[model samples]
Target: MKRYRQFEPVLISGFKILEWTHPEHNHNHYEFIFIREGTGRHIVNGHSFPYKAGSIFLLGPDDQHYFEIEQLTHFVYLKFTDAYLCRNSSGSTSAIQQLEYLIKSRETHQMGFQLVGEDNAIITLIFDTLLLLRKDQIVNQELIWFQLFTVVHVLQRNMPELRSNSFKSRDLQAMFCYIHKNIYDPNRLRI
Candidate 1:
């Protein structure tokens, strides 16, 4: 029932766990979690599923989840605030819009990623690359931005329902994001 808060735009950290430290919880930001090694049941939004190594999943601000570790689990979390997405949006608006589309459409992506074989390897590689880029405090913002987009690109290619042709138009996605962010402001919501 608790919701965690994150002030930073992006953070990458990993740890091994015998059991989850928190109870069922959601976050103020979004989280992209990779199960580097382990076996467990991921109880997400009341839906439970088994996960092992290479189990990748995403959780938006409103999604509630917790892990039931059946064996020792190593979790690498790539957490980012919505502000991260907004700030990271360079000139290419479509990609960010598409990602926002996925984030808002809970039924489409809340369960996370069910990847395997080469796909698993590729994602692991991307995350590993990100881990390295994030260390030593010499982080290249552009490079990190690109790699994060790559992860989103990979997710876009794999989620059949979110095929490029089927994605909401760029302007529509933008409007939705705009509206969602300014929901409390009547002036901002006005056309």
Candidate 2:
């Protein structure tokens, strides 16, 4: 098993798994899983989806989810706290807000999203950015922000059904507060 610790608030790691088993549980930080290759059964909030290549799973804070991977699998995961997302500029903040909306909509509606076509290239960039962020060097926050923006932009481009411009600043703040306060509660946000 491999683990990573965050000294700078966000942790990004990649894994190529021959075999993997995760205990049924949830986390306090937001999790983005980009599957480069594999097939599996993903069980999230009692809904199970067949996981395949190009599957992107976004698990918001404390969203009960786990996976059973059968056969070889390669994926990149990025985990970051809400505080980190909130620290960036308005556009970055809006992107994170959209992500939150997607997660909530996924959980509430039991919807799963798959990245296709040019979206794959954008996801690859996000993986590359994670690798760059791992190096022991003074990282340029602006560059990372740009990479993050690219990821969100691709997501927004590909998943227009999940996109919404109705989110306001107060809604973003309330969502963050709700996530922090009810992170461990499974019944907190029922569609």
Best by TM-score: 1
> What's the TM-score of every candidate structure?
0.79, 0.70
| lDDT of model 2, residue 69 | 86
Q: What is the clash count for each candidate, in the order shown?
A: 0, 0
In the range 1-191, model 1's lDDT, one tens digit per residue, is: 89999998888888899988889999998888888899999998999988898888878888889999999998988888979888767796988876776677665445677776777888899888777877742346777777777777777677867555456677688888999999999997876
Q: Against the unseen true structure, what C-alpha lDDT does each candidate score? A: 0.81, 0.69
Q: Which stretches of candidate 2 lie over 4 Å from their true place?
A: 1-8, 90-93, 107-111, 160-191
Clashing pairs in 2: none
- Summarize candidate 2's per-residue lDDT along 23-52 as a digit string, tens digits: 676666777777878888778777888888
